[model samples]
Target chain A: MPVNKPFLHGQFAKRGIKAAKGITGIAVLFIAWQIGASVSGVSSYFFPAPVDVYNAFRDMMHKGILEVYLLDSLYRYVVGVFLGSLVGIGVALALGLNKAIAAVFAPLVGFFYAIVESAWLPVFVIWFGYGITTILTLLIFVVAFPILYNVLAGIQTLPIVYVNAARSLGATRWQILREVILPGVLPSIVTGFRIGAGFAFRGLIIAEAIAATSGIGFLIFDGAANKQTDRTIVGMIIMGLLWLIIELAYLRPFERATIQKWGLVTTAEQREVQ
Target chain B: MIVNKELPKISVDNASIAYTNQDFAEPHLAVKDVTLEVSANEFLVVVGPSGCGKSSLLAAIAGFLTPQGGSIKLNGKQIEGPGADRGVVFQDYALLPWKTVLDNVGLGLKFRGMSKAERDKIAREHLALCGLADAEAKYPHQLSGGMRQRAAVARTLANQPEVMLMDEPFAAVDAQTRMTLQEELVRIWQQTEVTVFFVTHSVEEAIFLGDRVMVLSSGPGEIKAMVDIDIERKDRDLSSLNSNPRFQALRDEITRLVRQDAA
Candidate 1:
């Protein structure tokens, strides 16, 4: 009859099994890849085995190339995403609060959102010219639109009752904005941030490939150009692993602390029913 | 018992409410030429059928809507907009999901720039008053409908408003919970001097909770009748009221008035 204790244990057991299955899957893939490369008789440059890629990873770590490139990539990602998210939230609140301003700018924001971030990159490179400025601009552009759109959507869907309740509770306009509007739209802001962060990650790699002399994007590109295929494979693996870390460590915890804790997801579902 | 010892707390004269629908060129009139006065500390209940503008009338008093034709005044001051002087308890229990029950109750004090320690102390007192002392740290989503409404009531009461505007506050809860809440509300009203203006569609609710019930006719709502209940305050519980002759007569008369408008 004690449901909670057993349910918690069951959750832990389920997680353990899932982790074990994931490790097994990777082990199987690595063994198959190693065997296939050895039997194929192709040059390791063309089809490097898992062990060769591991060697290249060790080689880069010894030479400090991986550390430097990773730091550079992380710096760009943090600065770009932070600035973009601020701008997106700011513009969203400005337009969302005022009808006249929203009417004037909503269409323009939509028009820009329609154009892909990649298209803007060439123009950014032309304007800022092949450096951190161009890359940062591209990353910011990629991150802002999704966040802006989602936050606007959040503002639109927010219930009027919350505002009315706050007003009657003696909240000033500024107090309402701080206490009511911002918190009400927080779930949407988190959703937008997740999407924007993904787009920024991809944009960083592409921008570095085209514009920068450093970062993981450059490492991957330069490796393939110099016929160091194992190093290219190492860079690709790092990219995938880095994203997993960001998702699990940063995004998921943020969601767990805020939106999930507030039970806004269930609240949204209830609103839909109404 | 203290119905008219002083000036009327809220006065409305020839108030009309209309709404402009995008699809319709003509503005839909919800309430027309309504005039009413609520005395200090009076428990006034507005009861009517659907589309009777009972809610519109409450909204006007709460300052969410401005009466197009006439004026609504509170304590001889024109009601310009919403203020802490007049707190509203909504039907949906508009406690912020992100805030704990204590924080929601303390929100008005927070807006007044009260210290967290001071606000929390006051908030806890109100939570205890509402029988929600154990639920102070729980979020709104964690509370049941009745509890949520109770928290909302505590929230408005904590703000120390002169008048409490309740727009069908207990309508969303189950039948049993509604009865319990109604009794608790009557008890709470007795403890505080805050005047109550409650709106509902249930005639039984009107009779059991209100000192006087004002019934409104159907759309473009006008006052159909005003009935004063003679049941003793001590006999206004679900069990006692079920057999009280005065309670039954008032319920029947108000039900007939509401049904006539619906018909």
Candidate 2:
């Protein structure tokens, strides 16, 4: 007699199991933490339980403090990343196409890329003063270099045969740039955007902590300084959750739609064993 | 025989091609003092050993590389750069990985500012001709080697060039697929009036494809010999060529000429 397998034995089952595993891991951590907080003799202010953090989140939400701060951070992040990406891609294209310009600017760009964005925060604050301008400048600075470098590398490493083929097919210089060069470097552009966005996220938090009066970073720093440790934990948890949401909802889907669809890069599921 | 009274479709006068790079102390001369003429609608195949300048000569004509010495002209006019008049089918199918086969085929027309519907219609015709009708929505990476080369050929043909420059186009395909592609190529050439300038290392392929075969010597290549194959176009098939006495004779002569230079 043949063995009968269960109905849930394929892709859907596998995905369901993976999700369950993730939720179970988080549940285990929360349980352990709650148990430790209850048994320890330390004050709740220094080491708040998960329930205290949840209550703090509810209190902030009721007061509309969380909403305002979240929106402020989101606005800065979106605008800074948008402007930085546009500038980075534009400058890379201009410099990449002109050998003379690239020769002059490449080393200069490399110098700036090596210096961390945190080091520039003080200088930016002096130049722009502690507000949106200072924080935006830091965010843009943190975001542009990686994108510029990756895009330039993409342009340099593009196969010459594609250009030759396009030329022979009667593509004009402008058409070649639009049709061939742009699409050819799209994978690299996506990669650079991912790195730049991640950097901008971290930079936003740091800039907010030091320079801005309203944002998640400010909430975290202020809560800790005021001895509202539960509020600080709430801010930290929000930051982590926000990053996960961005990765799932935006970055991963964008990757799947472009490079993965084009078969330029393989997904983890599709990766072959060597 | 087709009369050659009119000016040749393409004329190369003492062309020399050289590559100057920092890695090399001196410029590497690829093709040296080469002169050749290809009449309109003629299928001319160039064959040689590795390191021979056959491909460089084709590149010079395609206007990818400028000849350091002489001039290559089309219809008695000087060739300056890559133009719509001359199309190339590369050995490695250079189709855009991001675009579908239909989009790739219609790219030239799109560059010319043709409307999408009009270009797609024309692209579909060429795709059908190349037996890639089913693969219109597929990417280049999704196709087999032979199928990709067929798409490359379709893309070039859709552009409607006067001359087609093929640089070892079938070199990467399997033997079975190569033979099929060769036969299909001959059929495609007969249906069109475009001149074919093909470069390859295969002697039998040269004999089977070309009206005239030009042999090039190794290193800084120059034409060693030019032989005319008097066989009829309809009779030239890979399966039947082995039994033909004339085909055998021409193959032996050309193989000996190429082997002599190889030694």
TM-score of 2: 0.95
For the second chain, the TM-scores of the candidates in order are: 0.96, 0.96
Model 1: CAPRI class: high
The Cα local distance difference test for each model comes to 0.90, 0.91
List TM-score per model, in order: 0.94, 0.95
Residue runs of model 2 more than 4 Å from their true location after superposition: A1-16, A268-274, B1-5, B21-23
Error of 2 at A134 (Å): 1.5
Clashing pairs in 2: none
Per-residue lDDT of model 2, residues A19-130, tens digit only = 7987899899999999999999579898999889899999999999999999999899999998888888988998999999988987898888889989999999899989
- Candidate 1: which pairs clash? none
